[model samples]
Target: MSQRQRLWQRLTEAGIAPGCHQALLDTGRLQPNTLKLSHWVQAETALWLDGQLLPSVPPRRYWAYHKPVGIDCNVRPDDPQSIAALLQQLPPGVFAVGRLDKDSCGLLLLSNDGPFAQRLLHPTQQHQKTYRVDVDKTVTETMLQQLRLGMRYQAGASWIEARPCLATLSAPNQLELTLTEGKNRQIRYMCKQLGLKVTLLQRTHIGQLYLPALSAGQLLELQPQQVILAAQQP
Candidate 1:
């Protein structure tokens, strides 16, 4: 095996998937982006196969999971219910992109490919993630308008922009909010700033990936088209 293939084998053993390696290579190519047949893994493929290398995955795989409220996004080597524990039986190397606190539930994306995961999680991509929040108090039109207008907040002696939250569902005491920035406990913090409390939180979408009809704790592999669309962004 070539040195590159040898390194790739080690990566797989270390829980990195092949598709991610392909993504890195794709990113390094010049314009008129075209992947040659040699890009495909072959028994005789050399380390210098492309004359240039990148950390990537060929056809990145994406998964949509219905995460339950009780499970943490992290793997607990000891907890069988953690996302990692659950994936152990299906395949190796899959990992969650962004995180959802243990108390929140809804759609989540996972992949064995590292480059794809990096793009989705990177701050520059600005991929919008939406959530459905149920709060303890009724919302006022003025409050909704404020949320929509980007409220100001104090973050330890510094001011920060609070992006507008688009409401998708509403009840006297419950609401679904769409957010762009994935700040830690941002929805809860925003509601608290407005004198409201969150009774429940669920993230329903990530870019074009939706929670769909999957019940909590179930996972579905993303279709090829879905992956392409997600990468392009709307």
Candidate 2:
């Protein structure tokens, strides 16, 4: 989408009240700023609104949130457990990265920076996400090897396509599984395919970033610089 198109869609989604959008176009309210200068527009452009200039995108923010079970990943205003309400004290447009299912819980990265998220999430990056899972059946060597072999399983209409992960017996009926892919409930689907029912699932790591001393619903901001530096170290 062009810078102009993106701005129009943003305003439309924000629910322009008692006004025609043509007024915005005619009145010079759409400020493209540096959006025209680059293919990636970060911290550069936003629609000028009201009587004054709406601020350009805020400085990027990154937070590692310990998301609890039952919270939806999206920022649905009506859902109490929506991430928007969960992180309401934070600035707007901050959204969760590395989504966890409503039943899954653990280290969910939240950031206002889209490019940074894309850097980590694009399938080719192969960033590792570690999950601790409790299962109803024994976690055996056979199961581990199958997952290591990247067993292809069909989950309903979609395929659970993931890179082979190292699955080890962490404890009886439990496994520590790490994957470079973040498919929806991929671990649970893997467990089910192996005849194990997932009793609990929690992500503990994303790349080099980890949750530290955070309780459920707690948000701890990280210095974006340090996070990138940490990823480069070792």
Candidate 3:
């Protein structure tokens, strides 16, 4: 068979989830759709989610946004301060790839592809996301080491351990950390556990997709390949 097809066969046989590759295909990173089976997997409806043909799916789109603090990442209609409202306008079905709590801000990716979102946000992917944080107390190497070694915290009714991540001190009160998975308000909670108060929490990168110098509340439309492929990278 084709080299690409053979590669897929080998990857699957090697125990990697085929869903990961298919998600990339559905996201449009596998361009020209050589397999022609791409996108069809998740399509609904003239929609040949490759060959089915009922109703065609909408063209995929991605965005890099610098969310200002206080703006919720949710899309609840009643929540006027949600990111959707902040955009003033947006195409149908567009949403944040992952959430950044209202109290935090930074590089947030938005997209219309569900599979892409699921794949990127899935904790198993362990895609590196970087953040810059400011705290109330002076930073220390000990704190950085502790953060890098991981933390155990409540998960539902049980306690669970977090995956280790990379951390470094940038200033007396500032830290740069890279995490593969994100729990809700994890940085803030973890810092509090270490006797520090988080003052600023800003995401600066998602995989290889770094935030351009956009001021808070600004965004730029882009192709999924520009960033979707990044989550698949080292």
In model 2, pairs of residues that clash are none
Pitting candidate 1 against candidate 2, the one with the higher TM-score is 2
Q: Give the root-mean-square deviation of each candidate in angstroms.
A: 8.4, 5.2, 9.5
TM-score of 1: 0.71
C-alpha RMSD in Å of predicted model 2 compared with the true structure: 5.2
Better of 1 and 2 by lDDT: 2
Better of 1 and 3 by lDDT: 3
Candidate 3 residue-pair clash tally: 10
Rank candidates by lDDT, best first: 3, 2, 1
Q: Estimate each model's TM-score.
A: 0.71, 0.79, 0.74
Q: What lDDT score belongs to each candidate, Candidate 1 first?
A: 0.68, 0.70, 0.71
Q: Tens digit of lDDT per residue, candidate 3, span 142-214? A: 8787888998765356666778888988899999989898888888878877889899999988888888889
Q: What is the RMSD, in Å, between candidate 1 and the native fold over all Cα?
A: 8.4
Of 2 and 3, the candidate ranking higher by lDDT:
3
The deviation in Å at residue 171 for candidate 3 is 0.8
lDDT of model 1 at position 182 = 82
